[model samples]
Target chain A: MKRLDIIRRAGRNLKQAKVRTLLTALAISVGAFTLTLSLAIGAGTREYFAKFLETNVNPQSLFVVADKKLVGFEGGNTGPKEYDPGAANISGSSYKTLGQSDLDKIAANKNISSVQPNYNLEATYFTYQGNSKKFTGQVGMYDKTIRGEAAAGSLPKLGTMIGADDIVVPESYLKALGIKNAKDAIGKTITVHVVQQAQTKTTEELQALYAQGGLDALTAATQGKSQDVSFKISAVAAKPATALSDNVQLNISDTRAQELADFTTQGTSQHKRYIAAIAMVKDGVKPETVKAELEKTGLTVKTARDLQGILFTVVNVVQGIVAGFGILALLASIFGIINTQYISVLERTGQIGLMKALGMSNRAIGRLFRYEAAWIGFLGAILGALGGIGLGTLLNPWISRKMSLGAGSHLLIFQPLPICLLILALVLVAIVAGWFPSRKAARLDPIEALRTE
Target chain B: MIELKGVTKTYGKGGNTFTALDNINLTIPDAAVVAVVGKSGSGKSTLMHIMSGLDRPSEGSVTVSGRNLHDLKKKELDQFRAREISFIFQSFFVQGGDSCYDNVSLPLEIAGVPRSKRQQRVEKALESVELTDKTRQKAKNLSGGQKQRLAIARAIAGQPRILFADEPTGNLDSATGAVVEKLLFDYARANKATLVVVTHDQDLAAKCDIQIHVKDGRITEVKQ
Candidate 1:
């Protein structure tokens, strides 16, 4: 039969059982809507969160320790002798630190991309207007500074001996400390107390002290208990600030904050107090490939993704559940379509028989039923998609408010690509749901159907 | 031509077995009008169904236009029925929800006739049934006589070699049924199609070229 003729006939048949068809269409649409909305929202949230984290830090930074035999005991009095914590080196002694020469080599490689030097000092504090503000700060102490900069003060001149006096603080710290202006904090003296672990005290006490007063106080306590070096104030320096999370302002300089042994403090001996020299590539560069290259150099490179495995996992789980709901909805909708079509079939038994008596092939009859169902599903999907997007838009503000996710000023982020994908998914569900019943109707025994009184 | 040989149709299994048709043999030739007269449970409808390939007999075989009905798959059987036969019911089973034109055009449409051809054919059929003016009207709007004529028009439109009419006048009053009967004969004569009407009405059976009496799933006699 001409497709047009079949369509016309199908349309007539559908009208004969209008209520049933509509109900089925509604059910299918609900299912499709659920599936689409869940997957889309979940995926979108992941993308947004990942980007937020990536923009703030080096996604491919790695830390490599020079420990060849490191191990730890679960209890203080161990059943087995504990090896040095950083002694298990991923690479041998032939492995070198990612110094200037290594960075120069990395820069030459096309895949290596941009590499920035990293130095983090923990025993840092800034003193503004004679009041000392203690905070944990990473001292990049870069031959070239990457991102850490005072919201107000100029970067210290290179090789100008940034010592126990020069420091910069993060904008957030300035805000938290009730310093509305960054200018009030410049030319300030800060103290950085580098605390090396002592043979005289246990690691637990040192950790407790570090956690209580940060690196500066921990270093001072360690020094008081063993080494006799008075902690002094240093110049103030700023830390990186972002809208995503909270950060503390730190005091940092180019030189050692304290006259502590480099190996004892910056080495395996000081397990709790560690500083990693992380090199960050630009945002667009592929972190994974560069990470592999860094791995080859015996430096343990990791993506921000690897470091935030827990966060990523949690987000994924949430998204998965939401998507599962969406899938369930789509499935429910599909069953709804099937149910509606089945009712239609029951109502149109006589009509189907009449068509067969008039010389319709089973295939033709099947096609008619299928066409009717498909039309219903297609309509439902289109409508459901519109409904879902509208719902997403409507719920955006409420969702953001509840989630506390700062999705900019717009309430609904109508991501066209995600929405399009959702629509496609819903349509597929609608179509699949219509399949079985349409076939069943098509395969009905002509005589039995005709005899359906 | 349609032929049935040793056809037996049994329902259920073992002790519950009941034969709807028992070793029935019959032949219906092209351009001939034949009628089967029987009571409600006399196997007339069963015979009609088997002849139309709507059901396969438990035993024996049926052939129409040299093709065995039992051998065709369900889909193939449907195709065969669409291409080779048209069936009319006593109730004048036009789809009530659709316009008369849509009802009459259904068979042609199902056969995948182009829309233009379907419209032309439907118009012609409606004209033949003298319901051309009512083509756009829903089947439910037509009178009883008009509905019967619409059914007749639909049956004839497909140009099938064999036309099976099951109590084509069963639901109509005598006067209306007479008119419908005349239209059936006229349709058969005009198209040179074989007509097989299964009915219990003696008057209707007498009008055909040949008449067969059915009793208890068996044929008792044939008259011509």
Candidate 2:
């Protein structure tokens, strides 16, 4: 028999058993819906992370930090030793910070083009026309590539070292200072008082002062004698809002930051330390090679791509779990196909006999049954994919809003190739599920089948 | 012509065996109307099955239209039956869920007749059975006589050289049975096709050109 005729007959047979065919197809749709949704979510998350990286990270830059084991006594201790008063206690661990020598060693590498140390500065109160306010503040060197959009005035030019008297404030500072607009504050000057331990002659002497008087004795010693530095506001920057870091209100040049540390530690023996540094690699050099060379110097190196890779791995795991469940549902539906097809064969025994008596080949009979299964699969996949896309579209707005993603961002994104491949795969699965039952129908004895009423 | 020489068919294995046909020897010339009449379990149906290549004989051979049925493989036999032979069953066996048009088109479809040609042949077959006006009605909705006629239309749709009717009117009333019988015989005679009828009705058997009687799994008489 011709394939078209067999397919038409199969369609007619399915129509004859409408309820059974529909129920079987429904079972397959459940699996298809889940599979499509999972794939969409995986694609959406990847796109989202890719955008985040593009917007916030510089591909050629690597963040270098002191190795955790070298920076902390928290992991395990070799032995207890005498304590040092000059060591900084950070996150419940006392460790020496990265200093000028560490920065120099990293900069000396052939692959590294430049190094910018992230300064850990002491906080101070801001004073403007006798009104003083304490706010959470940190001063960091500004890299032109890392700066966000400017709300007022222009960002200081790249490679222009910030003078000791230059400063940049966030938009929140303008609101707090009662400045009418960011442009108005750009040329104004503000005084920041640097409080210190009153310039002790030696490390032992400063340690004695800290132990005897704590903060009050130190404050009394520096009473009526704080160094007030006046700085002109170079620009007012837009608020930095991201999941990782925000709430910074001050920016300065790396040279100016080092100068403030020098002023505070005058007449003392302690050297300035940094928490981390950013190494900007030259273009066309592999970041991995630079990272490996830096790692040899006992520093931990991480590129933006590495962090993005971690996020991708996490997203892939989630997609895998969801797809696994979808496959399980499909496996269950396969049995449903087999069951429905077997029952159909039994019910149509006399018809089978009639066809065979009319000289229909066994291969033709098998093809008919398989064609019916393929039809069911096609219907199920199309319905399930459309359902998934519809539900995703309906839920996109609420999900985007909840996540604070801007308008037009989607949490479920569909791509054409994967969806089509998924549908084809499901059809193949249905064909495989129908194989045994179709073969049984094909091999049935015409005499016996005709005798079956 | 259809010929069976020393043919035997057995069911089951070992000690549980039962013979459905025993040493059957028969020949019916082309375009002849032959009736195989017998009581139930007397091997009339088995003889028809073997001769039609629907069942294989355990011993000896059956031949039809110069093709040895035993020499042909199963697939070859299917092709032979599809192109050369047709059947009308006692139960009608018309696909009830299908329309009369589809029921009549089955054999032609199996023969791989194109749609355009199949349409013409189907219409002619339906007209021959006098069911042309009911072509689109579902087979289940047809009366017994109409369903029987639909079966005859399907059987002859491929224009096969041989026709087999197994108790074709057994389920119909006397009046409906006579109408169905007349259509079957008329189509076969018009086409000059060999017609074999399996029946228990002596009156119906008497109308055929040749009669064969069977008893105890063997043919006891052949009268022409």
Candidate 3:
């Protein structure tokens, strides 16, 4: 018989035994449901993380830092290692110190376009206009690599850095500054105060300065006092929706931030120390290549892809566990198909005899039963996948609300290719599950089968 | 023409061997109505099985037309059966769940007839068996006589050159049995096809153009 005829006959036979066929398919559907849902959730989370990176991170940038082990820290390793005299991060080196030497090594790489050491801006108070009251909150740098959305005014455009004398403040700072709104605060001045460190002086030098200028000069030479810098309010940003970094009260231009950092550490032992630096890759260079080279020199380099991996690893494990359960259900359902098909074969012995006597080949007989199983699989997979998608669509809003992922974010997303491949794979599994029973049906003797009546 | 030469069929092994057909030689002419009559287990059914290529003989050969049945490959034998051989069983053997049209369409489908042309063939076969009105009804819903007619419709639907009727009227009343007998004979005469009837009813066997009587795994008499 032609394959199309066999397939049609198979479908008809399954239709004849409707209840049994559906029950078997239902068993398979349980697994398919779990697997498809897990796949959707997996794809959703991965895609969401990628979108998060796209908005906030530069793909062509690498974050480089001195490895704790390279900087003479014990790190996560258990065993002791031999010490070297040139080890950094020692006492007086300050926190997360990647000094001038580390910066120099990174700058020497051929693929690197520029290196900007992440500077720490220290401030004791922020006061804008007539609001002289000191409000202590963290200050951060607005650099070219940092992408932000403004609430009222516009942020720096692509390839452009924040102006040296401008600051971006949040809504809370606007309210603290007694400004009516973000729009009103634009072009207004905000002052940040820091205590400048006094330089050390010998008594001889202090006496010479006092002899030239009297008591006022002596007090000025020995005393340390607060200093304030002013910047125009250039824009306003909302509270960050991402979990990437701490929330800052206001942001200053990168150049001014560096100057503040330099002013704070002048004539100090930790003057050139840095916590992290963004190594911008050349236009056509792959970030991974430069990352590898930076790592070879004992620096820890992380590309955007690595960050995405870090985030998705957790998602993979969770989704894998769910899909694993689905596989277990599928394995259990295979036995269901075996049992059902075997019973079908037994029930249709006479019919099989009739077909065989009518000249249906043993191969066709086998294909008949196998295609019936394929039908069952196709039905179950379609039902289960559609069920997952339906429930996913309905539950997305609830999940987003509960997880506080802001608006327009979904926790369940279905992609076509994986779902189609998944259904095809399930159908193949069902065919294999039907194999032994189909063989039993095929090998049945027409004479014995006819005589069975 | 169907020819059997020194055909022998035995069952089991060593000590328990039972011969079902012993040294049977026969020649059946084309377009003839032949009856094989015997008591139960008298090897008449076994004879029919071998002659129809449903079973292989332990020794010798059976040929239909020009092809040696035993020498044919498995696929070739199947194709031969699909195209040239048809059967009507004692129990009516019609698929109960399928519609009358579908039941009759089975043979044509197995013969690799395309769907577009099978409908006319099926309708014609059903019309011949006088089940044309019951074409859409499930075979199980038909009475014994109608089911038997439907089985006959299925048998002739493939337009086979040879038809086997194994007690085709065994399950029907005398009245219905007479009707089935007429249908089988009419189909044979109209198509100019060879008809072989295996039966226990002596009266039914007596109506054939030729009769082969069997006893104890051997043919005892041939009547014309």
* Fnat of each candidate: 0.73, 0.81, 0.65
Report the C-alpha lDDT of model 1 over B27-118, residue by residue, as the tens digit: 88888999999999999999998888877899999999999877788667767877778888976778888888877877776666776677
Off by over 4 Å in 3: A66-100, A108-239, A242-277, A280-298, A309-315
User: Tens digits of per-residue lDDT for model 2 on B1-224?
Assistant: 99889998899999999999889888899999999999988889888888899988999888899889888987898899999999999998999889999999888889888998999999999998889889998899998889889999999889999999999989999999999889878987999999999999998999899999988889899999
DockQ of 2: 0.69
Instruction: Point out where model 1 deviates above 4 Å.
Output: A1-12, A15-19, A34-83, A87-167, A180-251, A254-268, A271-275, A280-294, A302-321, A363-371, A390-428, B66-76, B140-146
Local accuracy of candidate 1 as per-residue lDDT tens digits, A51-105: 5566644554543332212211111332344454432223232212344455565
Model 3 lDDT tens row, A14-115:
888899989999999999999999999999888788888888788888877765432223444444445533233434332345788888999899989888
Q: How well docked is model 3, in DockQ terms?
A: 0.56
Residue A146 alpha-carbon offset, candidate 3, angstroms = 4.6
The numbered model that scores best in TM-score is: 2
lDDT of 2 by residue, A339-452 (tens): 999998999999999899889999999999998998888778888888888898899889877775656667799999999999999999999998988999999999889888
- Candidate 1 retains true contacts at a fraction of 0.73
Q: Deviation in angstroms for A310 in model 3?
A: 4.1
What's candidate 3's i-RMS value?
Answer: 0.9
Q: DockQ numbers for every candidate? A: 0.59, 0.69, 0.56
